[model samples]
Target chain A: MNLKIEKVAIDGVLVRMPYNPAFCADEDKTLLHGGVLTALLDSVFGLANFVAIDGISSMATLDLRVDYLRPAKSRADVMVRAECIRQTRHIAFNSGRIWFDEPDQAEVARGAASFALTRGEVSIFDAMTQSRSSK
Target chain B: MTPDLATQQLRKVPFFQFLDFTITELAETHAAATMPFAERLIGNPIMEYYHGGIIASFMEAVAAISVSHGPDLQPPKPINLTVDYLRPAVKGALMAEATVTRKGKRMASVRTACWQDDDSRPVAEGLYHFLLV
Candidate 1:
């Protein structure tokens, strides 16, 4: 699924997912699946890592832990913001929170993840720059 | 719920349907499932590796199914989930097996592992905690 980026800064990113039946858990579509929520959290945290590393490198998740504080009510847009809390030479720690509507609203879930920085021939920044230059 | 009922309920989850995860086996304390490799499941398209989130989702679903089919007989609410990605999940069908370690009145714990080709070599593993209510 394509995640919508609401904002991106040096330290963090905010992503939004408008409720879709594909994201629902029950046949009745009353609840969003926890896996979908985890996917959102995971993406945001990964993007936070990108921002943290100045987009010079790419990373992959080593470990991710999520706590579901409450069921994410169905048919509501969900927003998540993730920030890199710490970084080392080869790893980054990130924290994220999910909300149904407003940012200040009670969180439906929270998560933390650690990512391993990958040294690759192509950096995300390089790809973006190349794409923009081509355009 | 009986194992059969829990398995049926698991199939109803939209994410499971989206990922094409099939519950291959369901027992009182254990559950097994499989996910076919697909382009949509790729996290690193350049590398063609399964997305970590997709793998975690698969593991979490299997863990939940294991608990749901246990003596509790109720669908669980996830309290927390931790996934450790040991290796890049390459292009192939991935299998997951989950076993319940503890089932209490209010909480339950499950451990799950996923493998692509070799059952002994896991690509990822997870520990899941759920609320029994």
Candidate 2:
């Protein structure tokens, strides 16, 4: 199972996927493992900021809301599309969609998220400045 | 919606801090350490594939990450996590990507998706909302 970063479009954004049998979590339903999904979503979003953000920065996902739209039926191929929709001085925003095939579009899910981008080191604010940081 | 201490407290749990616990990284910056796919992590009833519930947990984790990405904002505890199983995840290393769609004083909304072997077809999709306590 070699899952490499496939595409990193404009603005340093990164995209990738896994192609193997271990990516599966369940064998009966042919459904994917939850951890795998988490990995995919996390990678793309992290890459999104890694592309745009400057300096040695860090972010904590305060909230992650997900709504599953439909079931992915394909067994051979799967895809996830993500893009940065907005970026503020303090935070970076992005959105993404998943599809199994074309025409049908057959959307598997849609997501929108926010990540806090900051300069300086992580411990400085987490350790020293308590209320000075801007989110 | 600001989350209560309980929600914020979930981040302190060590069980939530494993590499396989990819979503846990959403609790804080710095990508997850490892991708642990233990046998117990496998899903049931899905047959030959993985279960969507496990995937849902990961989605929930990402949603948590999106809501709590900001340093100024304390990561919101998951008040509601709804997931729609799109398809079976591939049997291998899988990854997910998510970003904030909207953030308010009391609520945060985000989106995420699961990619398997093929970055073209998503194994699952999710829309998440966090209630600020």
Candidate 3:
């Protein structure tokens, strides 16, 4: 997924991913696979968690739920907004929605998830950067 | 339909092709598939763990086949899905089996479980709903 962060606020995050025909379900390449939307939501939720919570380390998705409100039929870019709704020492809850970048912007899917937090010395961001630099 | 025939059908789907899985079993109310670990499927680069979404997608693909599979099959429309992650999917092939819990004229429910090695130790379990209409 070629994702771009469009907005990041304390309450939520917005991301955009261009539509790819490789992710289509039909031979005609008109309709997208529902799993693509689910994957997008999951990724966006992780980003939201990373942005909202000042965590020291990594997190894992405990569960995920996604509802496809409509057939993901469009060549337009996909947009997703996600937020960490609540967070405790060991857990975080997230909610989000997906839509097209076109006008009317009908919601294609809605998702919610919970993550198991692992707070430690190094944040995932730092760890990732350090790993890349070391590599 | 035979598993080989089902796999041939899956090749037509771009998303399924991306997943690169094989239909290992097929029956009236059951479907199973196996997906080998690939770098593209990794969610945590440091740990090289399978992405949660990829696991869910693989399971959903098998679940869909369980509900409908044949030539000129009008694939069921997905309404919703819920996935529970039980364990970390490491760098290895993952297997998923889908069982159709209920099938009606207009709807169907499929339960899917995914595992890496031991069948008893599932990495994830999911429930999916589809609209036949």
Please tell me which predicted candidate would have the highest lDDT against the true structure: 3
Where does model 3 exceed 4 Å of error? A129-135
Better of 1 and 3 by lDDT: 3
Q: Model 2: residues >4 Å from true position, as ranges?
A: A11-14, A101-105, A121-135, B1-133
lDDT of 2 by residue, B66-109 (tens): 56654355545444454445556545666776667787888877
- Predicted candidate 1 versus true structure: per-residue lDDT over A1-135, tens digit per residue: 656888998678998888788778777886888988888888888777777775336787899999999888756688899999998888889999998875557789999999988765669646754765788
Q: Considering the two chains of model 2, state its CAPRI-style docking category.
A: incorrect
Clashing pairs in 3: none
Give the lDDT of residue A51 in candidate 2: 57
Query: Taking the tens digit of each residue's C-alpha lDDT, what string does model 1 give over B11-67?
Result: 666777788787888887899988899988877765678889888888888898888
TM-score of each: 0.90, 0.44, 0.97
- Provide chain B TM-scores across all predictions: 0.89, 0.68, 0.99
- What are the per-residue Cα lDDT tens digits for candidate 2 across A1-135? 233555776454434454444554323335543344444554466566655565525543323344456434345455666676777777777676666535666766565566666576553223323432432
Model 1 lDDT at residue B72: 35
Candidates 1 onward: DockQ, in order: 0.69, 0.08, 0.85
lDDT of 3 by residue, A1-135 (tens): 989999998799999999899999998887999999988888889889888888549888999999999999998999999999999999999999999999999999999999999998778767776887898
- What interface root-mean-square deviation (Å) does model 1 yield? 1.4
For candidate 2, give the lDDT: 0.52
